[model samples]
Target: MSKKWSIAALVLYVVYAVGMYFYIFHGASGGVPATLKGTVADPQTFMTERELYLSDDYSKIRNFLFFVVTPFEWLVYFLILFMGISRVFEKWADTKWRLFKNGAYLFLLNLFTTIVFYPIDIYRYSLSKEYGISTQGFSSWMRDYVIDFWVNFGTTLLIVLVLYWLIQKSAKKWWLYAWLLTIPFAIFMMYLQPVVIDPLYNEFTPLKDKELEAKILSLADQADIPSDHVFEVDMSEKTNALNAYVTGIGGNSRIVLWDTTLNNLTDEEILFIMAHEMGHYVEKHIYIGIALYLLSMLVGLWLISKIMPWMVSKFGRVLNIEKVSDIRSLPLFLVLASFLLFISNPISNTVSRYQETRSDEYAMELTGDAEAAVSTFQNLAKAGLSEVNPPWLVKIFRYTHPPMLERINTIARYTDKNEVETEQQAE
Candidate 1:
């Protein structure tokens, strides 16, 4: 029966992979947009021949790994359950304090999985280094890796312990209870992240360029955003990639620019980028995102509640688990949750892309600088070696923001529209 399940898992993943290949490479909508033809938004303009070749290679491998990793993780979970590794952890965790014992189990489980996944993680880092994306030394990279492991382990341990406690309290409706708790917990994390969690990995300080800081604050003031300061993180030490974002919640919220961005972009281009991020704040994308997340979790956890018992009843022996509330049953729960999340990628990405487009439009309106916006995106593509036009399935599965081609073309369209409007007003 375990063998049958394993075979079924492999077959299902194979079918998904085959479908993905055809959908990405041979789908009907694969081509440059109508907006880009004969325009400066050509892909050829974005990168040198050597850089383009390197970017294409990097994108293909990254996309391939995206599909492979999820199924691999699911299978690893199954293997742990089938091989009774969870039971071994349970034994090692035997103690008087149930929470402590569960923590031990979680730590052991995470340690095991970390070891199993280390090669993939390290290889990803190596790939970034090879592509000139990452500048950190291997030892520094390893330090960050260790920090990430402990952080994730601690977070998972806390969440899982609460989940199990909820299960003990109400086996039938624990998912509902857990889902409710998730809202406040998520908000708490958001509030704490910028001040606590983020500082652990990188140094963030007030933007040192007082002139640029004043410009950014002035932009914020015009946008009616309460921000009085701009923060910059020293990312040039670790990465060549450029990024800026608004993070945290309420008073904790602030705009942050990567030092790489400040170093690489002109003042006008930086303002355009900053305006784009400020759009997210003005339009309340953060709140909307939180609401959407809760809604998805509400439905997903409800489905898990129904499916977990059936699995436990039917394959309890094969999976070496007795019941849904058993801590050892975590691997099965994770497998189900992950599978659901994987299949929902396209839906989530569609919503994200829409939000990003709206933000882009808002930025164009606020900045009224089409040339700056265009140049900013062009520089972004060059800096990151980004593939401006990727496959259809890649857009659906991987793209949260519009492709660079689409963004630059949109700026062109916006420019033309604004010029026509100005002429009409004069007439």
Candidate 2:
């Protein structure tokens, strides 16, 4: 029965993955309209044919990887579970010292998973290198990869320690307790990420362009964001892609710009982008996002608590998992959580798109420069090689912001509306 279930699941996943690949690569249509010609949003007008080709190639491969990676990771965990590799790690970790035992198990599991996925990581790096998207040397990239591995392992260890402790304390309500603990832990991580974590990979310094800094500070003042610093990160060493963001909370809160952005965009376009990040702050999107995540985690954990036990009851003997609380069952928890998160991508992405739309609108209002807004989007699309309009499934699963086409059109419409209003007032 377990063999049948596993086979059935694999078949379903293969069908779904292949169907999505064909739908995106073959069935997807992104034909441009005649009206878009000569507009800033028009790919044919704006991007060279070589650029367009690279964009299409990168998009297809990226979409394919997105469809494949999570399911493939789940299968890896399932294989480990099925073959009792996790149990082997558990036995090897059975030392007299409790701390040593727990740490050893976690380290072994993390190491195994990281090793298995290293090839995929290298392939991703090679993909970026091939397309001229990444600028980092292989050594620097490997350093970052090592940093990520340790960071992930450390966080996983912490969470597992807390979770298993809770489970042992109260099997009936451990998920509830874990959820409560996660709220503060999540906030704490956000608070520290800007100060303690981000500097590990790249250097960040105060914005060098004092004139532009003053302008950004003025926008921050207008937005009532109490930020005194604008950060400029050295991303030229890593990638050619342009990016900027608002990060941290309260005292740590600051606006960050990639050096590539500063080098590529005009002051006006930069101001529009800065205003958009400020808009996220003014609209309190970060807090709202945290709230939504906590709500989802609350429900997700509760569901896992109910479903995991049932799954163990049905398939424990086949999979070699003794019970929910067994240390060997960590992969099972990860699989369930991953599945839940994957299925919720559309909902989470929709909320993100909505917030981003609001920020784009606020940026238009705050900057009062429709031309800058449209040009900023155009430059962004060009620098990133982003398709103006991706397929709907891509938008649903992947896009946090509105499509480039939608963004530019929204700004154009806003400009037209304002011009009509001005004409009415003059009459």
Best by lDDT: 2
RMSD of 2: 1.6
Off by over 4 Å in 2: 1-12, 33-38, 97-99
Candidate 1 C-alpha lDDT tens digits along 1-427 = 7677767777887887787665544553334677666566775665688987787777777777887788889988998888788889888988988789888888888999999999999999999999998999999898899999989987898899999889878989999999999999999999999999999899999999999999999999999999877899999999999999999998999899999999999999999999999999889999999999999999999999999999889889889899887788888888999999998899999999888888888999999998899889988887887778788777888888888888887887888899999999999
lDDT of the structure predicted as candidate 2: 0.89
Highest-scoring model, TM-score:
2
Clashes of each: 0, 0
- Which 10 residues in a row give candidate 1 its minimum summed lDDT? 22-31
> Which pairs in model 2 have colliding backbones?
none
* Worst lDDT 10-window in candidate 2: 1-10
TM-score for each candidate, following the candidate numbering:
0.95, 0.96
Which whole-number lDDT from 0 to 100 does residue 228 have in model 1?
A: 76
